[model samples]
Target: MKEDELHAFLTLQRIPNLGDTSIKRLIARFETAQQVLDQKKESLLKLDGIGAFKLKAFFEKEHRLAAEEELKFIQEHNIDYCSYKDQNYPERLKHCIDGPILLFKRGSKDFSQQRMISIVGTRKVTNHGVDFIKQFVEDLAPLNPLVVSGFAYGVDITAHRAALDQGLDTIAVLAHGLNQIYPKVHAKYVKPVEAQGAFITDFWSSDAFDRTNFLRRNRIIAGMSEATVVIESAEKGGSLVTADIANSYNRDVFAVPGRPGDAQSLGCNNLIKTQKAQLITSAADLIYLLNWQIEEELKPVQKQLFVELNAEEKVICNFLSDVGKEQLDLIALHCKMPTFKVASILLNMELKGVVRPLPGKQFELT
Candidate 1:
């Protein structure tokens, strides 16, 4: 909780006159933070990126006490400051371009894990997606991999909650700092996650929840994880950006399939069909695709299609899945059959475990 090293780092970050590229230039010449700060105006003028104008701007805006206050706040809150030199820094992310000079974390769990997976998707999830998430988490949790997510609503929240529910550590990579949590409604779940996992960010406490931070944070999620799974997403969504980043880093990407008509699922379906991601039907598929080893033995559930109806059952299953449950009359119209025959077929299908009959003569694909 001491603040000296953190305060110096924060002070260097707040130097308005110098950007990350410029800092790199300066660091290449200087040995330590103190050495760079101690250099006189004459020595500072010798740097390539720091000319007279920027040098003047740097000194004019410099305030030691303000930087000290930011450091104090971080310490008072029990937030840990991890530098590039910190052994605990994630090695995968360290090699990433535009990597942060430091990271701020609030949690008991280590960010470095042997196996890591990031789950990202749309904020508005469908009932179909909820079932996908539950099954995925239950299967992967036993592997003891670090599950990372944005902690947003829908798929993001669902993945995090499921990981925690299964007694696995899950990291919530925040857009802002630990100073304040965005989408405040999630506060109830966020706190307990810290005790078991972590909330991490590249920005310091002073950085606001700006638009660019979210995009910047996406890289961390991709960098830290070995692979990413997009459960459900829109054509244009933040989750796609993470998948792109993961692909750029040569990490594997997977997407769950949904009906083509489902708007929320279109993104995932497109990704798989377009060959941008592998098609994942179950958590077993993901484990196999990633070649992840589970400590506990995992056996794929044998699926048996019962009561063959002379090609009719296959057509009905595909039809209902695409358009959702169908009433007896609607099914007869779509299948071009008589209502009485449709009812009889549906009853037979239900008895054979091919479909589930609902109230009002509606039938669902099992």
Candidate 2:
């Protein structure tokens, strides 16, 4: 949008009582934010869902001033933004009633075309949770889905790192403005994230950082994705909130089932029991339920074991390639290597994300 148009949308966003949905309604009737602002109270009050209270603060001059200030900060920082009405707005988010009218971003990603999955969980993640996320991401890599998550601790960071590691595009839905990164420690991963995807938000540079910001941000995470997955969650937490939002949007919701007695699993189990989310054991179940086809080329993370493998590792990989999954002993025997030596090589391969160890001493390419 041009400067005046962008400023008008930002001005609409800055109004206190006027929310995205109401603003969208007003914009629909008047055709533009500027026109809406120019409209008379008599005409505005005549519109459905429009009342005197909603417009009480609508004509405040400070709204436009705040918008201009935010626009200046955006330009100064070189932040990229998109209007909800613009063709470049997130396609799935367009379906949401309360989707933000203006979204700020910094990165090269274009959500104009993509398959996104929002993965959220407690910051206090378990070892099992990490393993599940990594493996699930690896399995989903073939379809090349853009993983979406908050840039918080545990599952969010793990999901983002795993996606970048797989060379998949990912988007971090931020709770605050683009000018800052939350949980300052997560700062290290920002560059890599931006290189591969982006950090998107609706807050202006001057907006206050508050706990409520997270709940509001969850909608975008849920709104933009085709599905929302809860890797782990306590009985009450943000991930569950995200699942609720996804369900409200009529998006597919999946939660990994954990032991009933486990504290972190309680939320997911409840979701399953309540039928708020589908129970998925792995990415395969999610893929099947969503009917997502692997239309893109298989990512290296999905197929290649090692970008450049050692001769011994290559021998084992080739053997597995020829004979398919086999027991460690069988693999060692067939490759003409001692059991101890083969075991060590396989362990190294697993660390490099080339192989996955299975039950009964079996192994297979990741």
Candidate 3:
């Protein structure tokens, strides 16, 4: 975003009652942040959800002054930022109505990776949780997914380290501003993290550090990724909040099932029991559930005249041949079979070199 537009966005953020969603609503109607600020009070109040009270501080000069100070800080620190309207903003986050309007970043890595997943859990992660994370990242290394976490102790730090050790890009979402790192002890990981991926936040350099900030930070963790994984959690924690936010965004959420009696497993167990998250035991389960194993280069294969086929496989092959390419659900619907059954048959066909998987859960004859 240009300086003037960024300044306008900062000014909008400074307004006491106006939030990201409200700002977005205004921007959608006005076409730009500066345009929203230029409108008269009568015009602004005509929009739904914009009331007289919310606009009481909208025209205040103090907000502009505060924005100027923030702009100066941003320039001095060489901080990078992206507005929600920018093409570089996170693609998944743009679908979230409550996503931040502006995000300050400290690394060169962009959010263009095809696969990103947020791994979050309790700060009091157990030995088992640590082992699970390391193995999970190792297994997922081939796919080269971007790993995202809050950069706190226990589960967060472990996830970040696992991704780093595997030479995978990892994003550390902060609860505070980029001007300083919280937990002072984590200062060492800052450079390595910035080198690999980025440290991103919506908080200004001057924003106060508070417990509530972590809750706000959780949304970014959930919003930017295709899925959220709960490595371990107690009955209550920030990880659960992230899972709920992911669910609200209609993203897939996975929970590591633990022994029922373990304290850290309570939250994950409840999520599975309540059907808020899918149960995941390993990286293979996640890959299969998300259909992340589709090959990019599908080699051409001549039809095998002598290849034997079962009834279901023949049905799927015929359907794909007729439609050219079809998704798993559509194939299931037209083939008169359950979706899960069709998925199994497709896998068998893929192994038999009769078909190949495509992106977006699609399939076609080889």
Candidate 4:
């Protein structure tokens, strides 16, 4: 089925008050959306959150209207979507306990990669935090990692634009939908990213961009990545929420150590002091923490494996080997291949175990 249709179906199953946790448990018993729809009202009455009162509302005409409204928004905005059952859905996010039932997307790039990192922090950043972002991004930009972040002010926006400037595929996770880019000032970058990177959200376009949604979106950012980096966060900033989720997900959490008395750095310091986050001085620290080890000997072997490239594959492999890892979309953009063809070759290479997938659709030469 078309992905949007599947998304609508899943959205229907996970209406207000019925979250991913409950939806997952329900699906575990039923085989398909139709089965869930066909389930007897009495049977649903036995389910914990779905008592007779809720079950009646679920199968009502209003419920279908809500789903249709969501679908219409998806179609009109050119916002692609994926349900948890779809292969295109991010595996890392799918593994998350509260992964969204519907992911609203607007971009040519893939969200699921092997080496994903989420960079977050206070909206009111200090100079030190800005410098850290600039330098960290310069080093990380060349590596082409799929940098994930909220499209908020401060450190989050800084990281996204930097990755774009470095010609990397950066995905912004939104609490809203493709139809309305929150903090509308970021609208310009959103289009370019839609062409080059990606824009992902869980809430339908019809849904308001509520305060609670951005808080919920932070968990997706943390859960989808291999690690979460807080450039500089205030005592009560949203970055701390992302860090907390990262810790709970067992994903690495790193913070840029900042000077004392900097209000923006308080949350970061608190995290490190409490042993909640590791101190990171550079992108190398992140590279090391992820244990993305590519031995020196693997270089020659990689060269030999793709020996028949007409100078192009040789160049790409050389870049990849030296760089360690890169988003596959960046590779295809760099190699000038259609995304589908690049995906095909990467899949082949993966099957041969020649390369490994990283979070954010990145691939690293082994």
TM of each candidate vs. truth: 0.75, 0.81, 0.82, 0.78
Candidate 3 residue-wise lDDT, 245-329, digit = tens: 9999999999999999999999999999999999888875787698776453432345576778898888888889999999888
- What's the distance in Å from true for residue 104, model 4? 1.3
Candidate 4 whole-model C-alpha lDDT, 0 to 1 = 0.76
Sort by TM-score, best first: what order?
Answer: 3, 2, 4, 1
lDDT of 1: 0.77
Poorly placed runs, candidate 4 (over 4 Å):
2-14, 294-366
Supply every candidate's count of residue pairs whose N, Cα or C atoms clash at under 3 angstroms. 0, 0, 0, 11
TM-score of candidate 3 relative to the true fold: 0.82
Which 10-residue span in candidate 2 carries the lowest summed lDDT?
296-305
lDDT of 2 by residue, 1-366 (tens): 888989989888887877899899888888988898888888988888778877777788998999889989999999998888898899999999999999999998989646789999999999999999998898778778999999999999999999998889999999999888999999999999999999999988899999999999999999999999999999999999999999999999999999999999999999999999998887756755675544423433344532678999999989998877998789989999976577767755665667776666688887
What CA RMSD would you report for each candidate? 11.3, 8.0, 6.3, 11.1
Off by over 4 Å in 3: 294-366
Clashes of 4: 11
lDDT of each: 0.77, 0.87, 0.91, 0.76
Task: Please say which candidate is ahead in TM-score: 1 or 2.
Answer: 2
On a 0 to 1 TM-score scale, where does candidate 2 land against the true structure? 0.81
Q: Best candidate per TM-score, number?
A: 3
